[model samples]
Target: MAATHDVTNQVPDLVGHDVAHDPALLESLHRHGAGWAEAELRELGVHAGSAKAQERGRLANENPPNLHTHDRVGHRIDEVEFHPSWHELMEVAVSRGLHAAPWRDERPGAHLARASKLHVWGQVEAGHTCPISMTYAAVPALRHSPELAATYESLLASTRYDPGLGVPAGKSGLIAGMSMTEKQGGSDVRANTTEATPTDSGGHVLVGHKWFTSAPMSDMFLTLAQAPGGLSCFLVPRVLPDGNRNPIRLQRLKNKLGNRSNASAEIEYDGALGWLVGDEGRGVRTIIEMVNNTRLDCVIGAASGMRAGAVRAVHHARHRAAFGSALVDQPLMRNVLADLVVESDAATTIAMRLAAAADRVDDPQEQALRRLGLAVTKYWVCKRGPAHAAEAVECLGGNGYVEDSGMPRVYREAPLLGIWEGSGNVAALDVLRAMAKQPDSVEALFTEIAPVEGADSRLDRAVSEVKKELADFTDAEYRARRVVERMALVLQGAGLVRHGHEAVADAFCASRLEGDGGLAFGTLPVGTDTESIIERARARF
Candidate 1:
């Protein structure tokens, strides 16, 4: 090889490191009462950062799922074929209990433990988590129907990945999907035209189309349709109890911009059998539990992406050089890296806090806080993901724009979280709705922030601003985003002040809450402790 061909300046491959070595994440895990799972978290983190797992992630996306609507014999099969690596990734996720296991676990902080693992392992691949999240979320919704929950809850929570077309009763474990959005309805699920006619067997026959049914290969789906009473939620199985295919038809797979490894299809339920989930005409109320849980995962997913991007940016800067100095040593690069770290830390802190709320279902305050906190956090955190990812990519210069750097995948996956569960407007208005309907949620948010009332003046002022915004509902719908953004920042600032590292909390308060920073990332104020902030975000071997 020629001397010119030497790869002297290139950064080494990031592998064999603990992805869970994050300070904010670990601290929150212990503080939230899941300290016992630290060893397992670290072990999973090692695998998440391994070269083999990285390759699997890459391959799963590179070879996206293929839809086969029919068999060679002209029979309807409606199967989505994926690369072997997809199954490999799903197997690891299921075996580690990242899905529905938390709902059934008797231990405290089980949800927090699951959230921690999802945040860590999600870095390997974001697409596979789609089905995993749905499966985890489906449990709560299933509990709405006692008989159905009794039949499927245990299998859904089982740590076995059984991938095939089979009756739910025969499968060792199950994956679940949600089919709510229709062509005309989108976010307004009440506009759905799917029809569900009651049958004598205590089931309903669904006849309609779902515009976006993610993870179509799952064994079951929770969908919405209009019955005789009104719009209602129903559980539709892929294979019926008598070992026959349900009448659900695969229209075609969506050509999505990202999350390619997960198959989202436009499915037609042609007289598919379904069991009612809740009271008639209360479809939204019944499925809202699943939506909330998945929304929490959306926040966790965004935070995971931010962490991945920040750590990769830091790793690149530490090795790659420019102008006779390592990129990490450069002042401006330090500012950018530290700002990214601050954002990542803030997101991680809030995400863990929400998961802690999930663990305390019996506590009204925690539940109320989660009701309002999840909405605003989901809106702001996910809304910030794309910009955060873009800045992280730029930290790697030209290398990050390319496919192999893995930054492109991170960048692409960012926007999907904001869109999933609910879009920005939907989430923002949901906060307002929660305040109006569940007023306790409003007080709960303030109570959560009260602990750090005078800890940071900037945070205090931000909190006051949020209170004022809430007071004046004049065009509140129009100003929903603004109100929600401030709410999210105050909540994040409070969490950081209460639990995050000193440098992290200070940076977040200064830039995010006080508006001391510029529009883009890397614009933190001059006195910010860039080094300490960036150090905490670096991956450890």
Candidate 2:
């Protein structure tokens, strides 16, 4: 037989499969992009022409944008653009987006929220963050009409679009979404004291104050309130479909921690007529579909921040020399840089897969798989990215602490990722919930894995541990941890799906999920944090 064991047959096609979807590996779509940014920007008319225009347009980098200067804070905040080609257009939009009508200097605008969290988060970082939040929270509920859904997606698909096309071309030329937060309520959604009642005029009256309404200037909001059958989600508009005042109101701007370019508002509404979304009692569940997508946004932003910081820190380490040679020359620095590069690359892969799943999954079991995958991947990447970025900053010594270096911005951003959407704990709980609902999905998930050759061995060990854990539902917390831990395995299986390496969903069952060491984005804690910590300590410490 000529002892012919061809290397090609024996060795798997590497590029044929995108290993990036490994649980810890973030999807590669974003990493593979940057070229698409300008196209996307220009497509939305975000930047009209010239690279200099794009680089120069970021007003937040210098002047920073603001949102608190308007009387009617919620209906439609102004929009601003810093890219020179569209600077004038950006300024007007920014002003309108922030409700700062009639263009103004960026100083005062940023001042209200400069150092606060809102400023950091307000500006659009990744194109997907703002659009996703709006699409899920406001747009779906906007027209609730198929016409509107298509309109919403079209506008968002490309950031730089003519406000004239699709819904963006609304004569008023405005964009917005509903943001729901009250001063008193956190998880106790039922405690929302905001009242929406039926009026004699065949319309509902909205009365109450919302503590934190993101994108306050939104044209429409799927406002939630205390209605007849408990909490209800109602679609309220700035301008009714007829372009009349829908009675939407804005209290003031929130001036949050980060995301400065975007406005966070507090609003009060009186008689804001809105249609019920879904059924009356199903408000929480109905809106959850929207929130779930936003949660995914939080993950993308957090992961992107990690990548930005990593790239910068690594670039510096590679280029800037100290102590006889470049920082890249030092063993410790080399290790740190390598770790960052790998983590960033991996996080990108799985994040994209998570995004893909969120958009596509239809099966109830597959849906549950999607849910667990997003929850665990998000929790893991957000938590680990920060630690990695902060350490990368430490590698910068002192410059990273300063604002100019940009590492501080990203490091600061890392915390919000975990805190927003849902905490790691909440996501872990969701993982458990999903796992119980779809046990087979859980079993099928852990069946695939492939990594850096020898790496398969570790996945085998981890997966065996997962199978043993999933086999028993005796402990709720243990189940939760197992649910999240399987993120690694799900990621690997998903990689197969991404690469077309497998035809059936579980075709890659023969391989184990592989990853580099250090648990960047898939560590699952058993039970609640308090109990889990004590349990782990007793086991090893």
Candidate 3:
């Protein structure tokens, strides 16, 4: 008799379900009071979570973008060609108004709704998000110059997603890019060598090279150049009004570790025509609006990674059997999965809370929360993403190491968030800066934590410890990481208590706040209600 190969009980890939139907995400949206937009979010989640979306994500990454510097006739076209999957992803996001909904819709939960949409799409494909993020962030900064806003605001906020390269006057929609850092100064814009000369038309012409130009295919860019007054912000277009290409020449594309579907370029400007967005010397102040908005996205992106990782791991474990039982049923595996649930929940809750704060325009407390709390959450949440993804990978054992399993891509995407907008040290320094320069921000942090002041003793103690650290000014800069860590832990702990499941909240406070867990993921205290946590957070598909 021929020996037969057995193929029984192998777990299938997780797909064909709406991410909006995710119990954790839905609970988070409603718990954070964003249910009003649930119908729209649910539709987006269905598309993003579909098998087609998953295949598109894979196709886009598998076929990275190609740069075509010139036309067949040797004319300088400077175009970047992307796979159809990339365009499909962008169309899905843009048609849903993910790029401009918050600024365009003057509703109570506009930001919350928009954030949910972006978070869901990030899980599907993150590379297409770069330009979308820049376009959404450019609004506030452009408003600094009413002329610039009047010229571009409506175009930027249009629901149509135009990939055409030309002057904005002819486009149905628009996207923006940012070029701030130079080789000499990675994060220090003040050290840039790019120069901008005043033009007769009240604008300026820029001549400089940007070391890292994100989404180089964008129709417009918000960049900084050294003007006569000082470093200033400028709006550089890909094509001038005459339908001719600008002097922006593509240097080459950066070979990034991840985000391969997105094109990041190094380019030189040869008298590139640009318009000033604000006062000549106030470039940093104006551009900071864009930076802050992107920072918020960085935070949400990390949270989405955490959620995807956890859900994928839990789904695999539920179907894969070991020792004559499901891996998820085992005691130690249960602890690991549940711990991930807690971490994922904490990340999502805080992100949505920040979005809620963003929508409350008249609330000074929300403004303070935006100023200080955003940095803290960005630092901690983004910093946690890699470890969280690694833990989820380990739960899948050998399968997770392979590319088809999807865990590897998730892991690669994790570090970009913490590094983008600002590195870990930069985020920590900003947290300290907010505390010193804006005392009200510190007060806002306390106000957010007050709801759970007495609910959990562990949370209370963590808050007290953070307060003491804040009070002591000795070597604060040197201890910024530690200070910021405590602040993050306190905020996450309190946030869980207020908005998360009791078992999940208890596990988080016990493991994260009281230090019951070891120095890594899956080290939750032994007595955690692992099954309940997993059931709530496991991927339904």
Instruction: Give the per-residue lDDT of model 2 (tens digit) for 1-541.
Output: 5866654212111111111112222113332222222222223222222233323333444444444333465535333222232334333334223222101213221211111111112222432135334543343343344554554433332333233112233633344465566789755566789887976764567888887666554555776887877788776766665555655555555555655445566777866776666667677777776667666666666656665555456556655678777676665565555445445545554555555443333445445556666777767777676686687688677867876565665665677677666677777887777676766556435432333223344434555666676677777685575556566544644454444212212212222243433343212222212221111111000
Question: lDDT of all the models against the reference?
Answer: 0.95, 0.50, 0.88
Better of 1 and 3 by TM-score: 1
Model 2 lDDT, full chain set:
0.50
**How many steric clashes between backbone atoms does each model show?**
0, 68, 0
After superposition of all CA atoms, the RMSD between model 1 and the true structure is 1.0
Off by over 4 Å in 3: 1-4
Residue 413 lDDT, candidate 1, scale 0-100: 97
Order candidates by TM-score, high to low. Answer: 1, 3, 2
Q: What are the TM-scores, per candidate, against the unseen true structure? A: 0.99, 0.68, 0.98
Instruction: For candidate 3, write residues 287-321 as lDDT tens digits.
Output: 99999989989988998999899889889899999
Query: In model 1, what is the error at residue 362, expressed in angstroms?
Result: 1.1
Q: Give the residue spans of candidate 1 off by over 4 A.
A: none
Predicted structure with the largest lDDT when compared to the true one: 1
Give, for candidate 1, the lowest lDDT window spanning 10 residues: 1-10
Which candidate leads in TM-score?
A: 1
